[model samples]
Target: MSENRRAEVDAALADVDFEKFNYQVVFETTKGTIKMDLYPDVAPGHCKNIIGLTKIGFYDGIIFHRVIPDFVVQVGCPQGSGTGGPGYTIDAEFNNLPHETGILSMARTNDPNSAGSQFFICLGRVPHLDNQYTVFGKTSDAESEAVVLSIGDVETNHSDRPLEDVKITGSEVIVTEK
Candidate 1:
């Protein structure tokens, strides 16, 4: 199943001209809309994986499963828990990108190469995560950054799960000529 899904993703992205175009993922959530620009130059695999997932509606209706104040708001789990993925994992593409406010990075197990569909948006500067996680994108504007921080401020249980569901109602991958 994992391989099949991976093949599908690859086929979907086979015609993309990453160098001549820009890719962004716009997420419509219960809180508000947030747009993120992918850093394909730094993490092409992670960028492609996310774009592929979004294009296929993999993130629609997915809830933010984890939220940490002044840290990050996480989502993209199919089960609305921190344990599910899109059936496969991608290798880490750690780069020099700092994990500062509005930065988007992948969520994975202790294994460095275990990231799949799950990702998080930093609400504040998180230097410790720099070069540790794959930083593939970031909130495209101030409004988008504000929405992510607002989600981070939501009430949560001891486990960091949001008390009220913060869901991605829809998602779209926008490709524009550069």
Candidate 2:
């Protein structure tokens, strides 16, 4: 992400409330249920958008298309890859959330506002992304972080896209105490 672009996202979402907020995104994939822990206290705007999209079922059949080894597993589009989204944008809610393993966050293009309904689950701990991306949740298991990385990064001899099938069967919010 560019430094200028990062600044823009932060400026736009400066007013999002986070004092008493939380969210959970449960992705019911054909393989199994992948539940996401969303920290609105950290990324308020990002978490609000995620919950809104989930309630409307905007992520059905999406696949974990992009998976780089020791990086992250990107998903949350109707088509299942980073290539797909609601065709809109959300201002970057650049917060203090680190892109550590299992940290769920939004994905965007060079355009800081191009993050609509696409998100990713950090496969391994990538400390480099701290405050650069929005972190709304985390995984309950470190093992599952590897699972997302494996699923998204797996391909025939390292293709850019996944060669196998990954589907989100259902989606909903699962609330929990802070």
Candidate 3:
């Protein structure tokens, strides 16, 4: 998509009701396309940011900043995994959204409102992360198994982890009427 077209979409979304921002992500990657339902009801702004970045191709070629085997697979940093975004930041928003199976959350530093363009998908149900990370969406168990299994390497620490076989081809938002 062109930058102008993406900007138009972003502007259009700014007027959309928070609840109406709900949609699903069809992530077409090297493994496959995984469709995940977004919970704007939980974190509208975070989900909106995700949709906006995706529309602008901000996540293309961006590595999965952090991928913990049998835990979670995170991506969405134009800076390359832990270092990418739209050159801006958003104040972190918290809600009742819990970190459960397929839950989506935003990545932020110790400083709140520091979220740029990094997000993460819960590979499994994580109860400890409840009320911490900014969840935006969750992956459907049956949407696309290839996505969750596309891990190409294993890292020992949070220091510059990468998924050699995965790349975000693109994402689409299917907003629903409030």
**Backbone clash count, each prediction separately:** 0, 6, 12
**Candidate 2: which stretches are off by over 4 Å?**
1-22, 142-146, 149-153, 156-159, 176-178
lDDT of each: 0.92, 0.67, 0.66
lDDT of 3 at 71: 69
What tens digits encode model 3's per-residue C-alpha lDDT throughout 70-143? 66777776655465566677777777777765667788888878887777776667777777777777776664
At residue 173, give the lDDT of candidate 3: 61
Q: Tell me model 3's lDDT, rounded to 2 decimals.
A: 0.66
Candidate with better lDDT, 2 vs 3? 2
Off by over 4 Å in 3: 1-9, 12-22, 149-160, 176-178
Ranking by TM-score: 1, 3, 2
Best by lDDT: 1
Relative to the true structure, candidate 3 reaches a TM of 0.78
Q: Write the per-residue lDDT of candidate 1 for residues 1-178, one digit (tens) a residue.
A: 3323676777778767798999999999999999999999999999999998888888999999999999999998888888888888999999999999999999999999999999999999999999899999999999999899899989999999999999999999999999
Better of 1 and 3 by TM-score: 1
Local accuracy of candidate 2 as per-residue lDDT tens digits, 1-178: 2112333334433443445444567777755667777676666677777776676666776776766767777777665445666655678888776787778888888776678777878766788777777777887565545456557556623554667766777788765444
The candidate that wins on TM-score is 1
List TM-scores for all candidates, in order. Answer: 0.96, 0.77, 0.78
